[model samples]
Target: MSELYKKSLKQIRDLLANREVSVTEVVRACIERINTTNKQLNSLVYVAAEQALEQAEKMDKEGPQPDRALWGVPIAVKDCICTKDLPTTCCSRMLADFVPFYDAYVVERLKVNGAIVIGKTNMDEFAMGSSTESSYFGITKNPWNTKLIPGGSSGGSAVSVAAAQCFGALGTDTGGSVRQPASMCGCVGVKPTYGRVSRFGAIGFASSLDQVGLFASTTEDSAILLEAIAGLDERDSTCSTRPIEAYSQGLTGDLKGVKIGLPKEFWQAGGIASEVLGEAEKAIDAARALGAEIVDVDMPHIPLSVAAYYIIAPAEASTNLSKFDGARYGFRAEGVETLDELYEQSRTQGFGDEVKRRIMLGTYVLSSGYYDAYYKKASQVRRLIQQDYLAALQKCDLLLAPISPVTAWEIGKHSGDPLKNYLMDIFTVSLNLAGLPGVAIPAGLGVESGMPVGVQLLGRAFDEHNLLKAAHRLEQAIPSIGSPKL
Candidate 1:
């Protein structure tokens, strides 16, 4: 085996660019790693080994293109992102056999940049649930400890990078899916500000909150991937027209004169494990030592983030998922009579429990007469949360916060307790509501469980340049969390 899978994205890119390794060698190493580790982790639902090798051989013959930033690199895409001629099941039975005719904007960008798509990773079905257990494809275990969860929705994408199955992977973040999983898997996760990356062909769980994100083992690798996929796309009306920055060029690894704020509410909020808090504190102290000023800021609406996010996210989910009723495409129920029966049976049989729970909750909130009391109120609270972020950013260049209240927990620890799982998202959901950019970096291991703990650095909307710079600097200062034993 080549062991090329162990290299970071940049190293792989360099080797290919220098003609030190053929693209086929790199792709094969990744496929071998996936074959070895994926059974236990369940990180990938579909491995495009033959397709990737064919692409790699062609790339080798054509030679590297200087203009393509990711030339010859092998990367994975989450199951929810559409890839032409490839299965994009979203880890849900509803779309189990669904394959789009056209690539998603991000996937198109990846192809244009000469990157090889290696596989489609597992995720929470329709990107619901805080843990990856909700996927119909079966749970994705944490590589650090097979008994623990790797975090929701984007868990497989995070695990793919953490376990060296691939150099990087694309994921979607709707209320902390990317960052939470990265935290648990001990990898770098970047959730750009909403609209910074197009959502054109990504299957939506919450239209308003969803944004495409990426996972890598290092901050530099994350910046490189983000730069490749981020830009204006006329196909997506919500995507910003602002010019994309050379995010990788901003990595000077210096944080002098930067101001980072700590929200008082986050620290005061109950139930944060001591080890998690300790790691966050150590990160803040390290920032101060790096010549960044640490200041206290207040966001009173922070406490309402979880409640408001659930109502708002679910409401949007209900509307977005209505198209999966078996009337047009996707999985249709057999032996169904009448239109209503087909719709009912298809949805009932296709969606997982978590997806159904959110759909019902969403439908209830958006139903006549109840919309104002539930959906409308939650929207109002969401705006207040956004205002809170806006106000806090005024006092500092960025905000430092915990990614999750605790390290990765044992599998089935919160089984049968969805509320406990929802609460696990308390530290992450607010960033989505605020539409801000955030990068989750490993803050070292938990003192008690010895699992990874992560801290996030949040920047104002569309300000990923500064956000990555600060995160890169801090990443250098913190001790490496070391790769998982897998």
Candidate 2:
């Protein structure tokens, strides 16, 4: 049999059932892979090798659990997701040394499904930046080209999967964090419909928009991981009580009658590259070959989504970050004479510039006189954006678009201009505001850049299963096009 690195969940489960390889060996192979590749990519922030082995020993000696698909499989997590034993830093100095007493609901679900937590990968500080440059820990370089960025927030998670540091990983998506980075690194990631996955214990960025996502090397791997972790939880008020389906079963379902719409406005955007446009056209052609009807759709209000997202996301961010004011939790000043000084000093010292900027912007937008002018208008615009998507869905089963205008860009290319970095998230944020599901899959390799370009598929609220199926079919239609330097 081939090494575990090349096998998917199906292969692993069969091996575990037959006892071809011990659970300990499977997890050990994962750890060894991390140790080998993480040095070059720096994707993993903390590796729980000992803990994984201990869990594996228990599973092997005792026996695998029944009905749990992920039993003994290895998984990594974005640093923003809290793990009982690991530090949930959000890649910020404020919580640099802080550890949570409990696990995030997603983490707990994965554990219950018998998955092994390999480690916590790096991310943007408080999930705030686009290029991962805003992370206090340091930026996660693109797996395709080390000089380029791996997108933001979930950057580390994408690189980890592409590097084969772990079989799969859990990431958070607010403004395309999961899908963008997954595209940048040539991996597959899905942002579930907002309330499909419980968010209890996940560090908040934008309360209404925040969601846990998944990263894997293939659609089947991603679906298997998502199946284990997705579902409603009473603990999270936002979690939906709807039944979760078998995400893996229909990923390869026939696309004969599937209707996928391509928004004309998305491709016509000024920033989209020619190679990217060609690749997306080819993906549509391949889907057509599979009998999917490609219809031209219009989302007239799509252009304004970025502006509205910037205002509302920051508004939510400001209020959420107010909890980290030095005295309550996280960092505290060493030499403060007064209580107010301690709160102000520690926060100012611990938070990175981008975080502080967003906080200030958020506070300003929601401020006394400015509230009606900026925040209120943005809220109205947010509604319009959601309506745009809702209306578009009436014409087609799902909408298709590009994840990013370009492939992985050089790390320092946009670092000098903070606004440039923020613009990178423009295409991704509106879906978060609407609480819709989006999936990123490798479509083709860029001709000029020789990197991967991702195609995004969006579905109606809570229609992740449909979204996954569309992306999975397109991915299979394309050949071995992605080649991230994992």
Candidate 3:
């Protein structure tokens, strides 16, 4: 493996700018890394070696341009994110051969800024499961321990960065998919504020909750990628019109006068592991040592977050995914004599168990009679969750909490019981429910398994700037465990 594989996104950009390394070198190094490790980790669903190297060669001929923020950086995108020519299968048999015609908004931005898309990382089938095991392509093993599972649906994205296959990768967070996976893989993952980045070409998981997420080795990389992709998009109605922040630069790593909030409800919440909580407390102390005040706040409705998220997300997914009926595109079942049978046979054959389960749950909740009872009730609860976050954010600069209930679990530990896996997301789903920005930073190693433990800092809408700052400070105070040696 080349040393270039281990460089941070910022380092790669600087090297490219100074002509210390050619764009082809960086892209080839990453492709080589992916080729070397991807077999065991199953991180990448597709590797665009020829395309990436070709693009890098073109960039080398053109020379470096100071104006391009991510010029010549090699990055992998989650398979869920559309790449114009590459397959965007979402790791599902349903879209086994689905290659999109246009790039996702984030992908377009990366290309425009001269970032080479090395490949598409694996993900849960339609981004439904807590573990990447749900991916039709196969589970993505944790780089820290191949026996352990990488959290999903962005497990491959997290693993790609953690294993040094790429400087950074794009993931989507519907309910902690990005942050939780980053935490498990011991990398920096940021789920931007809901409208901070557009969702134009991302295959919808939960339309309202899904947001393009960033994964990198350092917080600065997260900030840089976020800046490169975030902004108003005429293509997406949900995208905000707010001006993008200069997130990569001007990061002081000082938290003086910053008020970090610890929600009482989070402390009292069920399922959070002791090590995870300890990590969050240590982060709090670290912030205090940096002159940031710690304040206790209440998010009374947080306990209902997971319940509400499942209902709302699945409901939206049921509706959003209805278009994949096998008639228009993607995998279509043969020998279907009628349209109804075709729809039934195609979906049954195309979708994995987890995807079917969610679709059924979603369809049931949205069904006429239950819509008023389940869907409406969940919507109201979702509002309360949002209000809880809004109220808590008013009391502090940002909210501090664990990214997941526990560290990465051994693969197949919860495979038999999907509900047990959902419980793993207790700490993460609430942020998505509230539509808030969150950055998960690796805090320490687990006592039992020596796996990575992460604590997240949640901020108000469009407050990624400060969230990254506080996270950087915590990162500095609490030493990282470093990358896994594959």
Best by TM-score: 1
Rank order (by lDDT, best first):
1, 3, 2
The sequence of per-residue lDDT tens digits that candidate 2 reaches over residues 1-486 is 445766666678678767888899899888888877787777888889999999999999988666788888889999999999788899999998988999999999999988899999888889987777777777787777888888878899998888877788999999999999888888899999989999998999999989999999888888888888888788999899899988888677667988888887787778888888877788888889989988988877778877888888889999999999888789997989998998899989999988999999999999999998989998888888888899889888998889888888887787667777777776788788789999898888888888888888899987877878888888888886644545
Q: Which ten residues in a row have the lowest lDDT in candidate 3?
A: 271-280
lDDT of 2: 0.86
Question: Which candidate's lDDT is highest?
Answer: 1
Model 2 clashing residue pairs (backbone): none
Candidate 3 residue lDDT tens string, 82-118: 9998999999999989999999999999988889998
Q: Which stretches of model 2 miss by more than 4 angstroms?
A: 482-486
- RMSD per candidate (Å) reads 0.9, 1.3, 1.2
Q: State each model's CA lDDT, in order.
A: 0.92, 0.86, 0.90
Candidate 1 residue 450 Cα shift, in angstroms, is 1.0
- Angstrom error of the Cα, residue 386, model 3: value is 1.0
TM-score of 1: 0.99
Clashing residue pairs found in predicted model 1: none
Report backbone clashes per prediction. Answer: 0, 0, 0
